[model samples]
Target chain A: MSECCGTTATIEAPVEPRVAGRIRTVALVGPPNSGKSTLFNRLTGLRQKVANYPGVTVEQRVGRLNGIGRGDLTLIDLPGIYGLDSYSEDARVAVDVLHGEMPGTPAPDAILLVLDSLQLRRQLMLAAPVLNLGLPTLVLLNMSDLMEARGGRVDTLALAQELGVPVAKISATRGAGLDAITHFLNRKAEAEKPVPAEGRIELPVMGNPRSYRQWATGISTRTKYKAPLSNEWTKRIDGVLLHRIWGPLIFLVVVFAVFQVVFSIGQPLSDAFGEVLNAGGGRIGALLGHGWVESLLIDGVWRGVASVLVFLPQILLLFLFIGVLEDSGYLARAALIADRVMRSIGLNGKAFIPLLSAYACAVPAIMATRTIENKRDRFATILVAPFMTCSARLPIYMLMIAAFIPNTPLLGDFFGLRAAVMLSLYVLGFVAALGTAWLLKSSILKASSAPFILELPQYRLPTVRSLSLRLVDRGKVFLRQAGTVILAVTIVLWILSHIPFHADLAGSVIGRLGQLVEPVIKPLGFNWKIGIGLLTSVLAREVIVGTLGTLYGADPATQSLGLQAALRHDLTLGGAMALVVFFAFAMQCTSTIAIVRRETNSWRWPAVQFAYMSVLAYVAALATNQAILHFVH
Target chain B: MVAIALLSDFGVEEADELDLSGAWKLRQLSELPIGTVGVVESLDLPGEIQHHLMHMGFMPEARVMVVRRAPAGDPTVYSIDGFEVALRRDTAGAIRVREYEGQNTRQG
Candidate 1:
């Protein structure tokens, strides 16, 4: 169902008249790890995204699986939800899709209740409710392979008799029984005869009572077993990774290693991407003849959008590895270990994931904070999330670190000790996040946090196709967002810096404004050009690089290659450090701010977030400026 | 002596290995006879199962019956808060324990 994106269908508006009446669509809904995703993957083959994390799969994925030997079929994979009592957007989306709550999102024709046969009855806990929802449901008894491997068995015949639905058993991972499953779906899709699912589950006897007992009947007859489980590699790895003392230390070290890889390995890739963008633009510019048309094509759209995309590989590499760690389930153990430590600092252990995300981009990181229930804690989390020193800061970090922070002998002792300087920036970000969270709790969002609770899914292999598709989709969103806001701001800043200007480029209106502002920032050692770039960065951080690329009289595509040399030869020791401090504090991305407004459901907090973080940046940069001058000058 | 009628994510090396046979209230799954009965104060896990169970108002007072444990010792099926849920023994271990009586059991 998610595969339908970017298809360029050419079918008319609203899903086409020819396709609408005959279209057969089913949505797979279940709890995380009940194997809904595995079923979706199996059903759609490689034509979809697999969501294996809690609170991800924020949007419903649509994919089409047509001509199953009978007719066409379509499947939409809704987010992994807990229940109809939806709390988060992920859960709400699931409910909303089921009810056709959003415009143009038609209600699914049927629901496939994907259940882990090992936990068959609990799977029914979700299944029965959907049945109660009156949607015709087909319970796919998934993970049957696990049942066999573990020596557990399900009475499929009895269960089907009990639920009165045609049950199809399949092991979604190894792709067994898929043909039969698809055939059954094909039958349902093609046949006009209404085979309504039979169920209004009676709740089992319990101390608590609610009539009709949809919950109770599910409890009464189901069976499960106690089994010994041993996987040597996991135990061995968990030795250090989940160790009582060293676990968190190892997690920190692993996280730091990833950052080092992103910062260092990403450089050459970024350089290569710059060349491609430049060549592509220059050829197009020549063809079009340089004018506003050429400028819009080369500089306005292509160069502007491509510059942000050059960072994609870095962001992808980061998110890909993060996804793997999460899928492998090491993240849960890390969370458990970190919980003891993070809880002390007034943040939930779960906040660690979003905080880590802040390194790639704060927009999603802030959105990811929804998993935290305590409003105050969640807000505090969002407040500090920006400080995590995301990938946006990488170019700036690489430039400044290469220029000012010379490699210590300790760096050569290990891989990229230059990474340590960047690592310290992350630590600084955390400190700022916590400091601000503490301040916010005491002042404005001053309420206690709900206790953090989460179930850790067992480790499993993450499918690459789904993960990559997800990266492309997310990167597309990031590019789209960065392009729109940055283009408009870049032109505006260009006008601001270039107009009512002197004959020379440096004396342009934007330059004079920077010059006027440079004195205020001089304590922080910023020159007017740096000031202008910093000002332009608020619309988008990538723009700061472009602003520099343009201010240095080089287009971003061509100019990025010599940035290290340029900054190194040009910037004073204090000047480089001060620039780092400024980037560290500035409210650099507008998408992040927009997300904040939506998440908080008010403009007030986003406004406050901007003011407070900016003030923190200014003060921090000034102090760093004074300290660097004292030491080196 | 407490014999764990082990319904665990880990298979029992011996049958009825966990001595959980007792009338345990819903609050005592963690501390009851190592494994006779199961108590579910809350299904606070991350997924939809937890969400549904909570919506059914299954909380601190709901009693559960620790039904059969598979030979492989996974997904210990139990009746709780008027609903049945199967849990990996690893998840069950995370539950807090208390004392229980025989009549408190929903499943004989």
Candidate 2:
């Protein structure tokens, strides 16, 4: 809908010629670990959200400027990157947009070059090339909150004068520094001004064409930090955190513990929701008097969407863990540890941020890959990004692992064992990703691995405001997406299963369809119950369980629960394993398919991804059930 | 053993007159070739070289350059691809090479 408001620049390679405007747009740029997003959040509020540019899966966040007193300004947050010389998809998009190469993407009237207060000199290296463009630039001194806490301060005015730019000191978290930015924005004169050729600095100092030292000196002079080199406390923390071994170990333990807690805490709430929905459905069905009205009340809409909604607790849990890790500054360290194995020669070490994000959701992760400068690495990374198991897959994994893996306690059996199964599924996704990468590197994507050239930013306490706003933005997208496409698919599936089967016809056409498919599914030990479950799952994989609940007499009292006992009573072991295999390979979620289409800019990849996944699901299910029947039966 | 240590972002042309032997430890340059590095052997082209040098990270402090030149030198490539770039033969002449270690025969 925002597209209707204006012709926005495509995030892929924005070459938006500046259209005539009473006001100019300003975009902030900085290195990947530069806290650019944190500052952007500070500037934009919850109005900022992520979207992919048409045809490219690149994630870009743009928000209307409200704080600068001029709601007329639009503040675009280009992906966080280390330099203009891109090595990944994110940096490439930033380069394209910075140059206004991406069509429909407007070049900023001016650039707000944000340098991390702790990592000023290095952050300026990224701002250097942008300054060369000669736009009226403002250098934002972010992370001032940390400076005070760490026993230091920066000389903002001196730094600004030295850089020949206005410098504002603000903690995007605490909401300081808006006055300086607003004063700059209110001036109409600076917006229309053209940058001199000297100010339009050319790409500098690769073969030593003289501009490198000049850029470095420009930053050195413009940037002043009151802290003595290597603050003692920071060094002490880094001694353990940046340690060769213990740091990574601590990080893994922390992440693993998060998953355990999520499963334990969220399971009961899931049950409550399931029970309430069923009770409501029963009341509605009884009041409607048992015809199409009864079917509609109990089966059609409620059952369809309910199945996927059951996964909400799981989805919310996943998002919470991700939010905490990112907000805690631990994710950055995770990236650092993963870097040695992940990054190769010829690529900047900074590309780690996006790759780590893939685990949460590939949509943003793929967009994040834009930070890499090398075309070869960028292209290769994009091509293989989908293989990383995103959080959406969590629901399907939880169901399959629960249904298939027996839950007798281990480790003196104190805690539930479902958590361990969940961890293994995560491990499987990771192994699958690595194997796929190895294959691509050897075959289609023969691009040599680039080395890690990166600036490991000093860690700081994350702001609650920024993290909460980000979580809100992400949560909104999940809900909106579910309410639309997932909602529709759930409706059609509900209809399909309600038509007619036996005398009373409590089950529908979908039930009949499942009966028809049972011959083929029998090898997987599926009865019509399993058949109906499979058909409904195609709407959204987790719907398989919810649909079964409705058909087998869902008691509103038993909502949001693992129907493991029920399924065990009704189906064989082979059938459960078959269901797991089916989900693992089926292209079940319509939302994901839609995202795939949006990301690839073509229907081809989504179609292919779906077909391959579906066929694999069927084959894996058949084999698992057939093998289990051959022995266990 | 002596060598010419010239810091350049983009590597030079294959045929050049300078000493490019022994190891070079690359520090940083702005814009170098995407995934390769080379040894610089001369000082020339102050204009074109500067743009690529700063972009690739051929900093004054680092040593990185061509480890070896291949037989047929059209897509002439350097071996080291890193933050501190190593320019190949074509790029080396543009950089003012110095001797940090061992310098070999200067074949023009």
Best by TM-score: 1
lDDT of 2 by residue, A1-633 (tens): 011225464333344434322235788887555567777776776677577765565677888776555566778888776556554466678878777676666777677877667546445566666666666677777766776776657677666655666788777666788677777655533434444335433445642223544555454544445532444554356457656566667766775676466456665666677788778888877788867667764676676556546555655655556566566655545555555455332222234455455555454555445455444455445544554555546665676567667777776676557777566556655555556456656665575433333222344565566656755765566566667776777667655655453332234677777788989888877887778777776666556656676665653433345476566666787887777656655667666665556545668766766676666667878888889889986
TM-scores of the candidates are 0.73, 0.70
Predicted candidate 1 versus true structure: per-residue lDDT over B1-108, tens digit per residue: 232222222221232244454633445243344234543444445444344445433433333456433222333435442223444454455454434443332332
- Cα error, residue A96 of model 1, in Å, equals 3.8
DockQ of model 1 vs. true complex = 0.10
Error of 2 at A338 (Å): 4.1
Model 1 segments more than 4 A misplaced: A1-23, A41-58, A66-74, A86-93, A189-241, A245-253, A360-382, A391-427, A440-449, A491-509, A512-527, A539-577, A590-608, A623-633, B1-96, B99-108
| iRMSD (1 decimal) for each model | 11.4, 12.6
lDDT of 2 at A542: 59
lDDT of 1: 0.61
**DockQ value of candidate 2:** 0.06
Q: Give the per-residue lDDT of model 2 (tens digit) for B34-100.
A: 2233343333444323433433444433234332221212112222222112233334444543334
lDDT of 2: 0.57
DockQ for every model, please. Answer: 0.10, 0.06
